[model samples]
Target: MAEKTDDKGQTGQEFPGFDPKSVEAYVVKDPQALAMNFARALENLGKAASEWLGPRERGEIGDSVADPMTDLVKTLSKVTEYWISDPKRTLEAQTLLFSSYIGIWTRTLNQFSGQYSGQPVASETDTLPKDKRFADDDWMKNPFFALLRQLYLVTASWADKLVNEAEGLDEHTRHKAAFYVKQVTAALSPANFALTNPEVYRETVASNGANLVAGMKMFAEDIAAGGGDLRLRHTDATKFAIGRNMALTPGKVVAQSEVCEVIQYEPSTETVLKRPLLICPPWINKFYILDLNPQKSFIKWCVDQGHTVFVISWVNPDERHAKKDWESYMREGIDFALTTVEKATGERQVNAIGYCVGGTLLAATLAYHAQKKNSRIASATFLTTQVDFTHAGDLKVFVDEEQIAAMEKQMNAVGYLDGSKMATAFNMLRASELIWPYVVSNYLKGKEPMPFDLLYWNSDSTRMGAANHAYYLRNCYLNNTLSKGEMKLAGKTISLKDIKIPVYNLATREDHIAPPKSVFLGSSLFGGPVDFVLTGSGHIAGVVNPPDKQKYQYWTGGKAEGQYEDWLRGAEENRGSWWPHWHAWAEAKDDERVPARKPGGKALNAIADAPGTYVLERV
Candidate 1:
């Protein structure tokens, strides 16, 4: 890729002094740091051991262990009750399951006798969407293994049906039960077993036990490292440095607060839009998702499109920030950034965009401003954000009273919700895609993970303040108070309906974190003209899509009538990235063109180059 010039027309090849090799070497061989980490690990283990003996912690542990059993028993009872009430329907389901098993067995017998030639049965919603797992193993393709896999899938499907369709259960109860059933069934898949998974067996034989030995070493090292939880390293740490490769957007940090720092990018166009663009990114992770590389950087694209862009790089909170809450985030984070943007750009109104949780915060901030009768926001855009959490998909399974209390206990003990814990929860949502693949590759096959930018960013997580997380989960996820106008922040109860700015919302088709339908429901809450777009691909890939790649198609012309299916049906499919469409929409809302501005302005001076200090802070 060609090197782009900054606002001052200065060409920079790389981050000034980033040395990946030195950083990697220090991380691997730093004796003092290693000793400190080991000491911390021991202390943490000691505390955990003591806590296990305490009454409160014991009760928490007991509840944790008993909750699953309680759910299982409740589901079984519901299923039994339904069967007793409706024998005919119950018999039909049982008969279908039995027939499915018998059919698979018959197919296997016929295949052995050279009488069967059809393909093996597979679930449309199989956890492993990709088929490369068993493609190279002839044994896996054989009728025996195929039959085994088919039986597992059919059984899992039936279990899920039983849980979801059980009578005398509320919708929430059914969803929770179905989620647990799916999780249990996924864990018990034939693919996870050594005898059934031909590929793992092949890998074991080929490595001659070396893979297992290496996996053991990795596991031990992780346990002693004090990071807490097992994190699969997706790339060699020595291969890439943060500012140099991951967050390479050319800009400068113009303003900083306790919560966030604002980065103002160098204008890539001679004439820029009169209204500046400010981005509010999620604090749960680094803000570089929109600025991964030149080819994929949305920030660069916006700069090149003649819009002066400003992005908020959030501080990765630690124990010191444990008391920070939702109000702090709005007042010290988004509100601070908005003020900085207005002062730096000398623009009365600015266009703003938010991603994921940041979008949630942005909506709240806009509402807060509306309550104060402020109108600094010209237009608003939300990317993969959920304002209404009624149907937040599998993540809702973890938002109930018990789970939230458990999470609170964990966070309270540590002062913050450990990023690894959050990462694990997300990985579980797509275990077949994210977690197990890494487990098999790194452990069973003894292979090094590929150095992919996206995966690298995924692994680089940020801790969440205990107070902030508790407030967010309880108010937003648990109570569904944000859309209901009952969420109190900064001593004010803000409502989404009060914000009347024109809105552009984008949702991914396969986003498991923030389901498309959940994101679409935001339209109904916004008291403004809403243009909703549905793009192809999952959460991260969908939002990072650039038009030059021409990879995924997006659908436009959807009116968010609080129904995802209806919106999708009426939407028109358009090829290429939704970035161009967003740019056009943003430009239409912007003022007339003006001479481009530099990174620093008269009021707000530049503190440091972009991908600034806040992003470099390690928790």
Candidate 2:
């Protein structure tokens, strides 16, 4: 150990600049300044405390109970001893703690400033540092954190009252809550709490990483690290899909679920409809996520419905396709496949199933065809997808100019938004479920991460072009132009109110990425009647869950279906799968004729392949 000396009798190296009696922050970065300052504070506290305690200890004046309070004050003075004694250890501990929170807060703050994983506006200039991406104050004034802060305060207040009022309470159990509450509540202030008592702040921040505070690493850390991954394995998975039991028709008809997968359930059933169902999948994940395996496979389910379903599996993007934008996706991806579906089926119209962002593109394609009075889309279904970008949820935080600029800078450095970074950001959105708990079980508990279908699915993230994301964030979310009748598309502004086709949309109640408020709002934006159903679970699981599992509840029985909310109120409260409900709705809309064509036989001109290039890039 290095030999050290202190001028004030403290146990650490002396920083003569600081004098706590003067209460000045003299030595800015010197570690020794902290120890010296703490020592001086204790010395002053001791002198005054000794004077106050002398008479009280001897049993004199003001209700001798003041003696205990005086002793308490004196005991608190020992806090300085640790600071002045273990200076190096103190600094290291404090650094680890505060830096942990700084990491999360810093990144989260950026997203609100529109510093998204994908830069929506690559041309925009950067104005803020990464740390101060969007210092709008209101950006940091997040509803979640604000609510959390208030809760912490209430928790601290309640716990203190509980222990103080309940004489028989267990002190040990109560102390744990008290310690955690004290630190969390203070950190909730969010205004440089680190400067107050950095050690305390550091401990609080680092606790999130360590699971010392519940829900810190819920998504990022492996559950096994804490002990074992708690996620139950529902089924075995193949390269691209999972297994689950769902209820559908039995035969050779192509059936598509809101999850964006085509199920060929009973491949030998009598085929229906005039066209073989072709599924236009989003270019985000592997095709198997929709087809996973036997039980959970939506593709198998479709075949059982007596329809031949062909799905599009997109190729993962690389530097070669760096210039490819949304237009390329529309021209090469959607339109090209629609023609192939038409060719294969010999039918004028084929049902289209789109999911999440895929649903948006499908709607866009519908708009493109509707402009020309083209009637190829017989039916449409949107799964956790959106047309109107109002109330875009936490994802909005990352749509600001600064955030975009940062993304452009980062992406320009590599030509694409690194798939992993995007994955991490989404994980942080629901850190409680996606990140922290596992960290505890892994690094702290000494275990391995457990495997779940969702985790496997999540790990398979997709790369996005810098240009496409920029246009999406700006034109859709930032401007709210799509729902406002201001979105300019295909040489014209396509009004959603013009496409009077029947529609079915699925929204998840617990989805943080696409909240029900936002997803359900799209129902009202449509000109045609919409059957919007809110499902259980988050974005992915809610849509992928099979009806056979019966683990979900849905709301049904709405009005005559003129408006969104009207239908919502009248929709009777019910339980079980929305799959059956969707099936019935689909069957009612069908022509009951068997249609057999190759692929891309819809309305548009055929491009090259059946599913096309972009949709086939799967895991």
Candidate 3:
């Protein structure tokens, strides 16, 4: 044991070095002593919260050993004692405080959330049958869940060791240690604040928007004695969509396929598109992301652009569709969209635009087609999408063989990944962004939240087929073989190098979910001519960006020569929205402008509305 020196009376003194092997970034002295003491003052925070609001009665908080809020209170007490004794060594303590709040939030999220759209937590979907029985299987072994569990164990072990070993650690060191605690704790109980400290929750989630909407939801739930929110808390609507596997008819949209139905908006088209544009949206979300409303819908924009657009709205997966894998998605879901588009436009080759996971599936679809030598695709666009799974980020933290087995056990019982669980995982990824805002308003402020169009849109989540999710995780993230040109799908090694089609990959600069690095991986993965685009804003806004939102400014650095590495090295930096640049590129590649043909054919079928039926759910 090294004897550490501490000259505390003098505020300004050289920090003594501690054993580096014992801690993750050992400090010479506590730099944040005062701050740690401040956090220590919050020692009564738990009791205060308990008395003012209420004690947590949930399983994780009330039952689990890794419960964060309880741990926070304990750590706060220790810090307070240390502060009262010698406030100089408070950094580690302050970090512990940080851990308390963060851990509470993360753990709470883990406890409440049900399932994600397609992403798995811990099951081998390949061997399991697809259906509700798949989800019912024991998912404790899920890779994601395992990672989550390990996150808890590792954090606790490290935190405990740091506190036990360090001596004369200033407030700053204590705070740092505590912060480590918060990070792991938050990873487990991100939504804990919602139950323990709702005030903070609402503010974080609300953002620039007010809490009127969230409040309205609570009021509806209260009035109905828990009918959930009348307006829907982004999750309910999405979950409902997942369970039902059908688009919601919120009385706002009616699906139709008539030449007159589509042409009514266009008085007379001057030029016809050489290739039809087919839109493929992820089944996990409502198709409206492609063609949301007139202001944001890409489908509407494409249709108005004189390009015949056909959008696919996937049926929600249920117990019956649990066994349906990527094969089903390609053969049934996406193939249906392709056929519908081909029939509508009387064109064989068409442009395919896919968003998020839909983009992944689209690439797979084209692979299936290319393997069969049926190349009807002229050009393809991927928005904030990653074909290569090497850098998928926090989502990867949940993937591994052990976790996969655990999840397989659960999904095997249920037949499909649970939508609630999927939603929970995403929420954990962005706990502060998604959960906190609701906490502050409804619980602390006792106020209502404004109905934010964006939050409302975010709350909508969906489910995925068992085999499809299993195939994606195993082939993409865990294997890291997708970008390496080593992914086998539908009885064939799906090689990105084989497809010689023109590829356009778009990514957001500040995106957390789909980081630019991951999205840019497509350039190298695809052997075809490639164009890498850098967009402004986040994952959703970056892709959903209609020509000019002006909210963000984009810079293009990827070279247009189509080689990903060469583009990375030589990619020039430009200012302003790349939408114009994209349009120009599309126009140049487009064969020629011909006479506008009459809209519709024998394939035209009338259905109801814009957002389609799958996305609009009230529960």
Query: Could you give candidate 3's per-residue lDDT for residues 223-332 as a string of tens digits?
Result: 23212211224333333232133322121211332111121122135775667666676666666555445566555555556665556666656667778887777766
lDDT of 2 by residue, 1-619 (tens): 2224567755641322222332222223444544554454345445434545554576542341113233323333343343445677467545644553454454444534435322212321231112221222322334233223323333445434433433333433233333333333333433322223222323333332222222223222223221222231112223333222212223221222212222222335554655455566666555555654456756666656656665655556666556666666666666665654554556557777787777777777677678889887878888888788765665664555555666666665556665655665576565534544443333233234565665666666677666666667677767777778777766788777777788888888788777776777777777788888887887877777777888778875542245545656676655776767776777778747664433323433333422223333432
TM-score of 1: 0.83
Ranking by lDDT: 1, 3, 2
Off by over 4 Å in 1: 1-98, 121-140, 222-228
How would the candidate models be sorted by TM-score, starting from the highest?
1, 3, 2
Q: After best superposition, candidate 1 residue 428: deviation in angstroms?
A: 1.0
lDDT of 3 at 401: 68
- Pitting candidate 2 against candidate 3, the one with the higher TM-score is 3
Model 2: lDDT of residue 309: 65
* Residue 210 alpha-carbon offset, candidate 2, angstroms: 17
| Pairwise lDDT winner, candidates 1 and 2 | 1
Q: Give the Cα error of residue 77 in candidate 2, in Å.
A: 32
- Candidate lDDT (C-alpha), each: 0.78, 0.53, 0.55
Clashes of 1: 0
Screening candidate 1 with a backbone cut-off below 3 angstroms (N, C-alpha, C), the clashing residue pairs are none
